[model samples]
Target: MNKLSIIIIFIVCLILFIVLSLSYTKLGTFDTVISSYIQHFRTRPGIYFFQCMTYVGSIRMYVPVICILSIYCAVRKKLLNICFLVFNLWGSRYLNQVLKLWYQRPRPDIHTLTTATGYSFPSGHAMNAAAFLGFIAYLIITEHQLRLWQKTILLVFTTLMILSISISRVYLGVHYPTDIIAGSAAGIAWLLLCILFHQRFIQ
Candidate 1:
């Protein structure tokens, strides 16, 4: 891993550790308020909107798009860039699942707005959204020589996409605010780890 990426990963991990510790100790009120706010956003219209956005954010269905991008990079002989993209995408998903099992927190059962099954502490939707869009943003900034304005636009759009997907999980009554927060942290950490791996071994 590059020194910068390693530093970023370390910082993210430290923050996550602190956040998780605080959540179970002194942040009870904070967690409750955030969870309530997320639950309040689970109105019918908002739920529908977020659910639709979640479908749009589905990485499984989007793999073809990633494949297309990867192929374009390969044709241009940017093999290392392709590897980074593919590895981040797959590795992030794997890490998300692993953390979900590790956390093993149950989903909210209060409102009965939507039926969801599985552990919910770390929202998979949020993690996947962050990983997918965050990697796209990284690729745009690193691999593609886009103009500054183009990079800004891409970053804004990807950020919105990730936020929308995260909101959807809460609106669907499947994940708590803390779940999404942890998922986002985990996603970022996974991306950083992938970058580190590439810098250390692949580069």
Candidate 2:
């Protein structure tokens, strides 16, 4: 990794550490308010859209779909992006599960709108969305042959997908706002780590 990228990664890791520490200490008043607002949105029709989209974003089940597409792209274009796709798909899934287990925070049962199992300190949907979409964004942006407009469109769509998936978890009442925040932070950290590794060892 370049000096600048290393610095960025350090900063991200520092911020993530601080955030996770504070989140575990106690829920601040603002945190409570934001969580309430997120739960309020859960009742709206928009949530259904986000929920379905988030479900689709789940990498555990979606990777096979992506693998199929990746195979098609590889065969048609003679591209060798399959290794990168597989690495990202597997790496993100393992990291998400590890973080979830490490946190071990219980899901919100106060208003229990959905029947989700497992801990909830970090929203799995948010993490999966960010990692999956962020990796795609990185690939599109880094592929020198791709047109600028195409890269820009891919970046925007990927960002929207990440945001929508995050909102879905909060709206579904399965995760707190802080959970999504942590998940997004962790996901970005994972993405940066992957990029750094690739640049240093693979690129």
Candidate 3:
């Protein structure tokens, strides 16, 4: 949220995105290694868990959750937060779409636990979950004067949700590992921008 922290996030996200893009485009050895590693560990339980997580992460499922949170925020007169949440959710999805079209990466031709129809360089579920849950974590840390353990627990849960969704995409073979990495990087970058914009203009 601070300038230095924002700069670090930007730098790291950029590096991750660019590296993943190049590797995915070239089908490089590193991409192969990571994707193979992820696919090798797939199990029935893991697939079911990830399928559930992806459903939760999907716009179809998560939009209602967002709506409920927005309503709560509106009742509290936190208009800025409500706006930020909607903007982050929709805006990041749009951004992810743009990136997907630009890359036009095809879905992997491996066994998939669920049906998916879209370009797969960046998993939309991963991006959306990271952006929305990352926003929730950010709000918690900034607005609540909670104890250290409380903040830590919340942040860890948020991180786990993000990772679980991303890993699920890989396990289901709908996305390459690089795709999730890129999605996560793009999501964090967008979320950071939204956070900075809200902090600068709204509060």
Candidate 4:
């Protein structure tokens, strides 16, 4: 996408975040309904599945992947790519923390399938999944010269990864549905801004 298009999307996502934040009380009903519905279908296999997906979204997975990618960039002498990658991931993580502290929203009172401790307005896992994986998808699309079939496969896989990670938080009962939505909006906004800056300036 062009810079202007990215900027517009960034703004739209920002507005979406703001709207969700302001309407959180009303959203709470929807959140509860969805959470309950998801929990209603919860199975032992589903729990195990989401547990793995949640771990994939965690820093445990992100840090190593980022380190490896950074090293790859270094070996290839792609300083700009290295900088953009680190800045995008680290910056998004830091922003997620700041937003969590700022919102200070409580985690769901439902029976949590996994242990989690934090203010949970915007799910950290959701933010990380959307920002990091979403950026990886963007990088693959923009950087690689893949065939149409390959690109389609990559896009589908990347999207599933992002959505699975985000939904896992809700499934685990540690985050509300609105939290996932808000985190996704914020993450996408930040990702777009990073891409726009990297493309327009350093790149």
For all predictions, the C-alpha RMSD in Å is 2.9, 2.8, 1.5, 1.2
Candidate 1, residues 1-203, lDDT tens digits: the string is: 35875787769765984477357435557666876777775666877787788787677566887899889988989788787788787877777777768767777777556667778767777777777678777766766689989988998999988898887776666777777777887777776666666667644
- lDDT per residue, candidate 2, 60-145, as tens digits? 56768677758775876725566666677677778777877987888877765557888886777777677667876776566557
Q: Look at candidate 2 and tell me the lDDT of residue 195.
A: 73
Candidate 3 per-residue lDDT, tens place, 1-203, comes to: 47789979878998899888877777657666877887788877877788898887888877888888888888878888888888999999999999989999989886667888889978788888888889988876887799989988998999998998888887887887778888999888888888888788765
Q: What lDDT tens digits, residue by residue, belong to model 4 across residues 34-117?
A: 999988879999999999999999989998998998888788787788788888888988999999998899998767989998
Ranking by lDDT: 4, 3, 1, 2
Is candidate 2 or 3 superior in lDDT?
Answer: 3
Model 1 lDDT on a 0 to 1 scale: 0.74
lDDT of 3 at 46: 77
Cα displacement (angstroms), candidate 4, residue 158, comes to 0.8
Report backbone clashes per prediction.
2, 0, 0, 0
Question: Higher TM-score: candidate 1 or 2?
Answer: 2
Question: Relative to the unseen true structure, what is the C-alpha lDDT of residue 113 in candidate 4, on a scale of 0 to 100?
Answer: 89
lDDT of each: 0.74, 0.72, 0.84, 0.87
- TM-score of candidate 3 relative to the true fold: 0.93
